[model samples]
Target: MLDHLRHLLAQDPKLAKVGLTGGLDIWLFRNSLKILEWAGSARDSYNSGNTGLIQRQAVRILDYLDGTQYVQTENIPSDIQPILVDPKIARVALLEVSQSEEPPGYLKHIGNHLREIISSPNVNDSQKKLANEINLAINNVQSWYLGVHDDAAQLIHMSPQQLHQPGTMMTLNHMFKLANNAFVGETDPATNQVKEGVSQIHYEAQRLATFDIMACSNNETSRPCV
Candidate 1:
């Protein structure tokens, strides 16, 4: 069922636009994962004669589907600085399946094709420049997609003291803002506020700098700040 829904959304942007507004896609994707994970638990409860457990789960599902679900955002480090984002992009970012299981390769395939074109010795200067620009754009989008998960994963392994440090907290907030821009298909202000079409290579660079600072602060000789 989850796979079918993902297929439909991937095939039809119009359908996704209508269905995924206001972070409904996030709630739906997460709840679908929960329901799948708990299916066995539900079955066991049914076999144990605790029918109320199934009934309660059904009620919760109904409530969530009807938009009564309350997500507590206070503790989520990545959500510390909330901003508007396109629902469709948000859904893509939170996709749980492996890359091979994704619907189809779009940006990556195009990027590879562009790289070949750019690298060909026969290509004209103008054509090579155009291809380079397109490749740069594709790379930024790919970076945005990867950075969200990578930053969140890093935060997950950090100690509470590390997470709450002044520099780390600032970096988290910056990352959150960058994510909002990525999700909404907006340019990063830090890189492109005055410039028209600068490449967005900010998030990963910021993340590395923050990690280096944190590591140095902890006196970890292995990864001293450069």
Candidate 2:
């Protein structure tokens, strides 16, 4: 199966060189990459005198991305490949690279939740230790992410990605389902019932970690106690 995966990338040399790390490898080929590609293309459309035109182009890109979060208009992956390769567009694109910086207390909530998960006896011992580490990493990442966000807010102002990161979108979709299940029950009110779909995703996601710590836990069970 792993060899088959490698062969799939071998088909496209450009894609083959994307060099995705760990789980990120899966998101490299998704549709959101096209948005980044479009942003790079927009650089060509940038006009210092015509900010409105540039904004329109940005909006056009946003229109394509129906469910983006925060909108990362800064420091996108290099492989995303910005389009609209103009200096003005490039400048705008810089600020508008990624999401609108993660929300305040966002990581705190994540840490608290991770602590709970790790503390749960049901999660098992080794898993508990790993969860503790997960909480620590979350603590560090949230701090740095917020700091970058502050810098972006103060000194950086570029065009934001008009679409949701593919990974984020997928995670949101999953949370939406979980939220639908957890809260208000799944009742349809004509148009699938106007539920807090977006909120639900955030709510559920807060409980889950980015990395699936349980992925290989089965090995611990299957292998004999050494």
Question: Which candidate tops lDDT?
Answer: 1
TM per candidate: 0.31, 0.28
Q: What would the per-residue lDDT of candidate 2 be over residues 1-226, giving only the tens digit for each residue?
A: 2222232222323222433222211221232233344333333333233333433444334322211332344333343333323222122211122344222122343344456666554555554665455444444333333332342222112333422223323322333333223222344567775332222323333333333433444448754344
Q: Write the per-residue lDDT of candidate 1 for residues 102-218, one digit (tens) a residue.
A: 322334433444566567655556656665665565555446534533444444345545544555444444444434434334644688742111122222111111211233534
lDDT of 2 at 202: 32
Clashes of each: 0, 34
Best by TM-score: 1
